[model samples]
Target chain A: MALDQSAQLSDDALLMLYANGDPGAASELTARLAPRLLPFCNRMLQDLAEAEDVVQESMLRLWKMAPDWVPGAAKPSTWLFRVASNLCTDRLRKRRGVGLEEIAEPADDRPGAEAQLIQAERLSALDAALQTLPERQRQAVVLRHIEGMSNPEIGEILEISVEAVESLTARGKRALAAALAGRKEELGL
Target chain B: MTGPNDRIDEFELDALFEEARGESPTPSDDLVARIVQDAAQMQPKPASSEGHEPTGVFRQFLAAIGGWPALGGLATAAITGVYIGVAQPGLVGVTAAELEDLDYVSTEIWPSDDLFFEEG
Candidate 1:
């Protein structure tokens, strides 16, 4: 089948197609999911290179698991997010004295020079503030706001109650605001 | 009254976060390529090992020489035939050679009893 045609399928359907030997399903799933998983992983790990590795590993795991995947048991995206989150947590534990220097400068795409600089500063401030949050809180906030996932889905990915997810996001956002307290004027908030 | 500096409100903080989200870095072209390559490599192979194996020559020979069930029946018949002959020989048909031996043994025993009476 054409990749565009497969694009209309759900992530679960696409994975089923891929398991059944549909060549286009793999590419369709990759294009559809890599962008989301990569950015989320980058935010969690704060290292682009490691995040990339985690994304690749996470996708590889999905491919390996496609054969046994139970349809309707869970959404493919949620499962992949869970896998990436665990991988990030493992890497974070092994990291020794993580420093701000390891944070990759995000891609700046704004048109004007001043706008681009301000955007860069805002992203930097946000990233630094995020890094200060506890790992679970940071994960909850990123998945909630940045990834645009609902509380139940975030709960599923993090294996927590929806109430816990809500609590984590609330605390995380408050902490982030405190961390970025003086940067509001520069960030144009 | 809320001070102007009372950290950013939820709405403004949300807007700032939304902007920051927009600036999230995409994976490098090389990284995407690597992940696609990994996907290609990890595609699940077709499972075809569930069927039974092809029957070999030894199995064919066994089938030809009265497979297990047939052989078992034959063994049971042989055992029953042996048991009937030994336990109740009368059920067996009498043969002429066995009758001749029985007559000779009867005459020899009676004639020897007459010789014993004359000697007494």
Candidate 2:
């Protein structure tokens, strides 16, 4: 398939093409999914390197699973997110003994605009606050609020009911607010 | 005793989430390249005619007879039958002419005298 045509294809369609050994399909899938997946993994793992690893592993699994993938059963992106979510959970479980403060903060490399710096700081604070949340709540909040996914889709990714998803996000937001309560003045919120 | 004034409101938290959304980390080019490479390495090969040609008649016949070993066994059995008929080895040895002269049609399989003696 041509690159343009592959770009226009749906994730399920691309996966089918990939199973049939179309080289273009893999690249198209990577371009479509990697960007979305990386940040979600990064948020979950709180480490860019680990997040990158998770994304690569998840995509590898997707490639292996392409042949057996049922087209209408689930969206490919949802499946990918679920894989990444479970991988992140496993990593987090292994990290139980590690302190959150010990996780290295990502360096800011952007050109310094005063407003941009403020925005970055606020986001950094939000990320730190997010780490304090329970894993399920953090996942729900990130998927619902930051990723702008619907509750039903977040439920699917987290393997929970939609009502449970709603409850998680609510509790997660409350925890985040409490964690960041003192920083309101400093963050200029 | 956390006061209400100390807590960040819902609006403030929402604004922070909005910032976080806008500031999602972009994947490094190296990471993207690595993922694509993995996909390439792991992908299933396409269904193609090259390795999947239709079963030929010879192959079907071979399969039906349970392949080369069975064929060898059958050939051996056939050669032995031919050897026995043509060579006629003299181990216990009735000659071919005597064997041919033996009457087959008038031979009684069960003799009446033997049956009457066994009954008595």
Candidate 3:
């Protein structure tokens, strides 16, 4: 199928096409999914290179899974996010010994006006605060607030009950609020 | 003792989250390229023609006849029969030329020269 036509296809359809060896399907899926997964992984891992690796590996797994993917069993994006979320969790576990001071700041390469800079600073502070959260809480918060996913969907991704998801996000927000307590005036919030 | 002023309010937190949502990082071109490459590498190969059942009537008929090998054997037998008929090979102890020179006559079931037949 042509790229434009495949773009109209659902993730499941694209995956079926990919399984059927449609060359355009892989590209279409990459275009559709990578951006969404990248930031989620980045927010979870807080390392661009590591996040990129996780996203690539997750996508590779998706490609491998295409042949066995039952269309109606689950949404492809949901499955992809679940895989990525787990991968980020594993990486975070491995970095358990690392100190918080070693966590690299998000690269700010964009040239913008003062207001844009302030917005970037606020976002950076939020990201740092997110990194301080426990892995599950961070995943829940990012999926809920940052990724704007529904609570049930976040629960599905995190393999937790919706109530648990709400609890985590609630606690996560409180932690973030406390973490950024003194920065309200500094961040122009 | 934590003071009320020390903590960011829910309104402020929500604004921060909104800003963070707006700052989603894009996957770099190189990363996308690598991911596309990985997908292409890991993709399942297309289902081959051998895996599909024969569809058309002719194809089904061919399958019923045991496929190409059976058809080849049938063709060979046909061609050999035609060769023996046209070329008149002498393997059967008689040739077309010899059959042409031979005479065939009708024989009666009862001969009138028999004495019992004359009396009857």
Candidate 4:
């Protein structure tokens, strides 16, 4: 099938097609998912290299499970995020301390010289604030706020109830606000 | 503590989330390649023409002799040969002249007289 046609299929369909031996599906899936998953893991782990490893490991797991993948059980993207999130959590638990130096620099390397640096600093500040949150709270906030996922989807990823997701996100936002309060003037928020 | 104007705080938080999202870096080509490699290695192999191919001796035999069709053809030829040999020996018969030229067999009586004698 053409790459364009493969791109039109939903994530689950793409994965199922991949399991059936269409290499195009794999390309399309990787293109569509990796960009999103990378930053999610990066933010969660605060280390770019570890985040990359987690993303790869999570995708590997997904590919391994493709043959037995149940179409209606869950969306492929959701399943991937859940896997990536879990991997990040495991790494986070194993790390001694999340030093500021360990966080990966901003990923966007476009030509806007000074503006780019400022954006990176602002992002680093936000990541620092997010790191202060409890694991579940951070995941809830990232999924709900940053990724723009619905409460139910966040719950699915976090393996919690929708209400629990709401509570975690709410508390997470308050904590983030407090952490970033000192930087409001600098961040121009 | 929940403040009186918490709605404002929520909106501000939303803006912060948007900024964070905007700053999110796309994965590097190297990382993407690694992921694709993993997928390539782990993806399941396509099943045979049949939905679920048989395994064990039958499967190995089919594989050994090319595929199922080849094995089937071989078996059919063998069975036909066996049937012809058993049910119609004349189909493969050698003529008397041909048999006479063969020194391995003797036309003259080679058995003792007692061999043909019935119990008397």
Candidate 5:
């Protein structure tokens, strides 16, 4: 039997292969990491279109950095998230007047029929509150809370101490709760 | 506060993180595909080699130009001369007599100091 992914080849191993010019490794990394990055970017930019742009740019950066990518130096997912965070922050700073999307826009325009009517408002509120967070806190929360990276892993990706990641995530969660707490009825959850 | 402090252990924070993470919204397949396509196209080029160049007369010339400062200065001077040669006379186009008469009706640029500096 072929070995399972986590046992046969971890992300770092695949990353090493990618650094050595394995196209398959690159595709595998893309397939695995894209899902995690999409939500993280959507949370930060709040506009689905802009979030898509940031994630694309970030992945391009990762590919460019792959040749010199030190194996075991970073988890591919963590690195992608960090790069995506930085990209979104750049847009947030540069794009004047851009803000969180309004929570009430109907989700009918999207192609996927996956937008659940029940959790629609709650999810939108959560997205809006996430958009309002400070860039670093938002990054820390997304990597830690959303991506489930360890504190140390986040610390490495963020170039900070584990304690700092912890502190940032805690403060971020509090801010998110405060921002979304008052909108229960409108959020419907 | 029962925040991520002494009261609330890292495990609790970790658990909440896991729970919250599970609520992640899926991205449209189209979006992921577009981004991945861009990424696949953006594979970084391998570093180029500047070393081990074939030695030749041009290489010897470059070597001597640096070794002899005067030659280096002469090369720069020649380059500057060529630039000036191409550029200086470009301003002195010979307009046809009728064209000049039509154009020069206002400005006294034929053979006067105003041609050099007007509106004194």
Candidate 6:
């Protein structure tokens, strides 16, 4: 799973491996892409389980596209992010208001119970506020903040101009900060 | 890592982003393992992507080569190159050498006559 660059094949390499029916490519691709993409989906859907499904489906598409998929037109990571984002948006549109649990944190293997509860509360507040925004704003905010992606990267992922990505993100952050105004205390940020 | 092009860069946003990324909400290991195991068991459906051509095929081909993980792709290309290059010239050269070994050139005049003329 792209561990230590041993399996750290390039997108083209992975695609070739994929073409040669190397399943390792799939795993490596997942390892590299999933963490970055998951939060965006989780924020978008406000449902961790659904976001996980979206990640799987996104990887599935990569697998399916391997045979005919070429490399170089777009960044593989970016393409996957875009596809995952679209899938999450679709899922959100299909099932509105799930009142889902906070963005499910990975079961924290460390820390005391009090710390865990506090983190959970922060996540819950953030998730709720994110869920209340308009879809476009949500996408912008998630991609920019949650995913820590740049404007140009977000632009390409969202299929919009860089300027537009910036604009959307600006509006989104303002809206989010407003939605989350009183929630910072719970967030401890 | 705020920069000239950055649109949003408040401490609050940065904190949120950090918290979002820092959380371990990644799918459970069991789930990841299941996905991996399920993947391990999967067999390629068609086995050959050669027949399936998509729109912007060339573009996708280029895209695959655009990243750091393309060693397999590069190897595949190198292998193909060797197959095309060596298989044709090296294979054909050895075959031509073998053909020369089997070639029989007949001479009407004998070397013994020329030896007699030289000695006598």
**Comparing chain B with the reference, what is the TM-score for each candidate?**
0.34, 0.43, 0.43, 0.35, 0.23, 0.26
Better of 3 and 5 by TM-score: 3
Residues A1-189, candidate 3: write the lDDT tens digits. Answer: 877788788999989988888889988888889999998998887788999999999998998889999998988899999999989887777777775556665433334524334665777778878877888899999898888999988888888899999999999999988887765666676
Q: How many clashes does each candidate structure show, in the order listed? A: 0, 0, 0, 0, 0, 21
Which stretches in model 2 have alpha-carbon errors above 4 Å? A98-101, A104-117, B49-120
Candidate 1 clash pair list: none
Error of 6 at A119 (Å): 3.0
The residue-by-residue lDDT of candidate 2 on A118-184, one tens digit each, is: 6667777788788889999999999999999999999899999999999999999999989877556
Prediction RMSDs, each to the true structure: 11.9, 11.1, 9.6, 10.6, 20.9, 17.3
lDDT of 1 by residue, B7-83 (tens): 67788878877886788788777977887787778776545433656679867866887798887887899998776
- Residue B71 local lDDT, model 2: 88
Per residue, candidate 2 scores C-alpha lDDT tens digits across B57-111 of: 9889889999999989999999988765655444325556776787743433334
Residue ranges of candidate 5 with Cα displaced over 4 Å: A1-7, A97-117, A182-189, B1-23, B39-120
Fill in the DockQ of model 1: 0.30
lDDT of 3: 0.82
In model 4, residue pairs whose N, Cα or C atoms come closer than 3 Å (at least 3 residues apart or on different chains), thus clashing, are none
- Encode model 4's per-residue lDDT on A63-172: one tens digit a residue: 99999999989988889999999888878776737654554444323343342247556677678788888999999999888888999988888889999998999899
Candidate 1, A31-71: lDDT as tens digits: 88889998898888777888999999999999999989999
Query: How far off is residue A113 in model 4, in Å?
Result: 18
lDDT of 6 at A7: 65
- Computed on C-alphas against the true complex, the DockQ of each candidate is 0.30, 0.53, 0.54, 0.34, 0.14, 0.11
Model 5 accuracy (lDDT, Cα) = 0.66
Report lDDT per candidate.
0.80, 0.84, 0.82, 0.79, 0.66, 0.67
TM-scores of chain A, one for each prediction: 0.89, 0.91, 0.90, 0.87, 0.77, 0.80
lDDT by residue for model 5 (A90-156), tens? 8777654554354334333444333243554445545556667788998888877777678998898
TM-score of 5: 0.57
Which residue runs of candidate 3 sit more than 4 Å off their true CA positions?
A98-101, A105-117, B48-120
- Judging by lDDT against the true structure, name the best candidate: 2
